[model samples]
Target chain A: MKILVPVRRVPNPDIKVRLKSDGSGVDTEGVNFLVNPFDEYAIEEAVQIVEKGGGEVVLVSIGTADCEETLRAGLALGALRGWLVETDEVLDSAAIADVLAAVFKEESPDLVITGKQSVDTDNNQAAQMLAAKLDLPQACFAFKVELGDGKATVEREIDGGLDVKEISLPAIITADLRLNQPRYAALPQIMKAKRKEVKKVSLGDLGVEAKSATKILGLAQPPARAAGQIVGSVEELVDKLVNDAKVL
Target chain B: MSTLVIAESRQGDLRAATYNTIAAAKAKGGDFDILLLGSGSAAGADSLKEFGAGTVYYSEADAVAEYTAESYAKTAAALVGEKGYTAVMMGATTTGKDMIPRLGGLLGAGMVSDVIGFDGANYLRPMFAGNAIATIEVNTPVAVMTVRETAFDAAAPSGGASAVAEAAAVGDDRAKFIEYRLTESSRPDLGAASIIVSAGRGVKDAEGVKQVEALADLLGAAVGASRAVVDEGLLPNDLQVGQTGKIVAPDLYIACGISGAIQHVAGMKDSKVIVAINKDEEAPIFEVADYGLVADFAKAVPEFMEKVKALK
Candidate 1:
């Protein structure tokens, strides 16, 4: 099985995020970036699948040169190779899928893996959109996966319960946090990844132009959370939930 | 046109998400109608009727049997297409983020995941985990968005609602149902709890967590751990309350023995109220906390529990 892992590199999880000058996007002027935590699980899972089942793990990403860091990180974690679908501007989910669909056509990965959602956009739509566009089976929020006998079984999270799903090979699955522990890159592997090939393909060069069917008019900020009223006792708190706030 | 708030329910009662979505839909300041899509969840519709759901289109059929992404997306697309809702709102839980876009694709509607608030086409959402916020509006006929549960208020039940059941256009079996396994962990629901008492590496290990959990139980809160604790395997990944683990907007979020990290704060900063219990008064969490208690957590836990029990 040849597994494909698409990832996003977002600002480090440690910094207080600032908006761009125009408030159009995040201010990444001096923020550290890393592989999206959930996508790390996807890459790790794909590598494990290939390690066990005998195939290649291909790391895929859609971003600018900055995202090369994320792709390289995936390579260090055990992916066989890395590919970059370079774009000038941020691509929306469907547009991203359009470019990925082209890659799918060429690579023909037996199993395509993605994080449940991108940590930055948190759109959580790429894998499903790709599956819909490619007309393939999609199992999402998967915490566990098994592939054997030409079929893949995925454990999915449902409302108040769980439902198991089985799909044929050549399916798409999105990884959730509960899937598995993503390993830290060994220093030796990181050194080796420096020698590995990370091929970058521009959207224009790939003959795929990013055209969004929907246009973003603008972004808004969430209401500032009010300063909490700290009460003297738990009894007062329960009273608020029961009488004042009436949540309980 | 009407608003479509996908009501989330469990064990015949509505989840906090349903109420949050309802409050948001009403923010449009118009006639509100809700769609309850699930397997044999008619009770959810009945309970939610008092929330001024002028109409309830409940789906009861094989299509709604389980949360198959294909079925929900197909059915939701058909519903929105046929009824022509002003907006199709969903709870931005794990399920909504996965299913909404598929529905958007099926109906050829515009998709926006994790919309905390909106002014016309512009919507508010978080970036860099939850440290910064962004607003974007889509110029599309149908705007399908996932409601950030932490951002909206739970709508109160009001008068009455007219409920109707419809056969789902999408069949549950349209796509194959995959295997699902549930992992049970010790910590309380980081996102849904009223009081979340979290510990970081300062707590030391599982035994140290027991000290924190003991205090949490006395206070009727859930146990949460920092990413550091989670990274050290002192707790499960689900118990990690941070940008990467679970972003909880509970009523009262507390930190015990934790030196606040940005990732940890990003997960709980939106909480309605906060208290920090740490030795270091200068911890970043204290900056956002409404109340600060500087003391040795080892001593603080027993003292706090004693006070709580005495109050009780």
Candidate 2:
């Protein structure tokens, strides 16, 4: 079974966001990047699958050239290999899905895995779009999965509870944070990943290298928050809410 | 001139999203009839007559009672193909996000999610998390889009004139819901709340959440938190407001001690008024905040409360 795990390289969640004065985009200069936290679950889930099933896990991503380093990080974590579909700019969810659909056709993996949403874009569209494009079964927000003969039983998260779903092989599944606790990479694994090779798949090769129809017009920053002066006690604070804010 | 709208219904109740879809259609399509699909939702469907829905279509079955994206998409696609409706819309909830792409593919329509506004099927949505907004033009005839709850004001629940429209039986063999769990809140939702106050990792501990709760209590506002704080196990998942969490569009939002990640901002940027309180004015949250205060939050929070309390 070939398991594909596609991830996004977003700014480290631990790092504070820096917005430009015009509120157009984040200041990426001199910023550290890491695997999207949600994607970490995808990588971990894939690794666990291969570890149990004895097949290989292949990690993939469609992003700018800088993401190559991030892809290498996936290799260190335990994927057998990596694919970097290099592009000059970011692709919208649909365009990204188009590229992935073409690649999935070639690879013909038994299972496709990706983060439910990217920490950067947060559109949460890629996996379902890919499933739609490929006409494959999809189970999203997967909290757990058990693979058997040609079938996969998945537990998906819903508003109030979990739903048990059974799907055939050759399906697309997107992982959420509750899916799994990703393992931390040891130093030895980091050093070993330096030697692992990454197959750089260009957008031109995917046959859907065209620019997206969506146009980004403006970037905006979140409005400011006012500092609250702490009262002497919690009791005082509650009173303030009742008397001043009149909300209590 | 006829439009097809999908009213999101669950557990015998018509969701707030149904109204948003109607508002968008009234503003986008000159005429539209709403198609609401769910089990035990006939009364909810009948309630849509005032919202410009000329007709309401509902199908209820034991299996369809639960929200299955595949089943929802499949059923919606069937109606769309035979009826040849102008467009299909869903709320961008957990179910909608999973279901829309499938519907788009099934109906061969283009999909736009988290759209704040639209004009003739050309829609605007937040991209790069919330750092930037994109306007996408879908050439597909049956336009499929998800409207951000805050993007458009919901029209009055006058379905104008509505008749019961029959739909095919609900069949969702691809997915099934064996069980579910939820974190139901008694207070107003953050998206619907007029005032909101949220805390972040800067608060350091669960005890710190009290300050947020107090502030929210004072303002009669909802309490929210950054994903980092939620990840820290300081709050429930529902209290999280961000890209991976709940999306909000309150009239005023006060982010306390949150440095502001793009994902967090993406969820709350639609709020009419934003205020950031942090010791580091350089924090990205200040960029979007209409008001910024640089001071020790511990000190500032109390002072602000005093000023607010004095008004009483």
Q: Pick the candidate with the highest TM-score.
A: 1
Candidate 2: stretches off by over 4 Å: A9-37, A63-67, A85-91, A143-168, A200-248, B119-121, B214-220, B274-312
What lDDT does each candidate get? 0.74, 0.75
The sequence of per-residue lDDT tens digits that candidate 1 reaches over residues B1-312 is 477888765434556787888888887666766777666567666677678877777776766755667777777777777778867888876677767777766655567766677666567777556655665655567777888777777888777656656635576442576344544655456656788888888788788888988877776788888977876878665677776566787777778777878767777887766777777766766777766666667876776666556655
DockQ of each: 0.40, 0.30
How well does candidate 1 reproduce the true complex, by DockQ? Answer: 0.40
Q: TM-scores of all models?
A: 0.87, 0.82
Q: Give the TM-score of candidate 1.
A: 0.87
Which CAPRI quality tier does the interface of model 1 achieve? Answer: acceptable
Classified by CAPRI criteria, candidate 2 counts as: acceptable
- Candidate achieving the largest lDDT: 2
Give residue B37's lDDT in candidate 2 (0 to 100): 70
B8-80: candidate 2 lDDT, tens digit per residue = 7666777777787778777776667777777666777777777767678877755466666677777788888
- Model 2: fnat (fraction of native contacts): 0.32
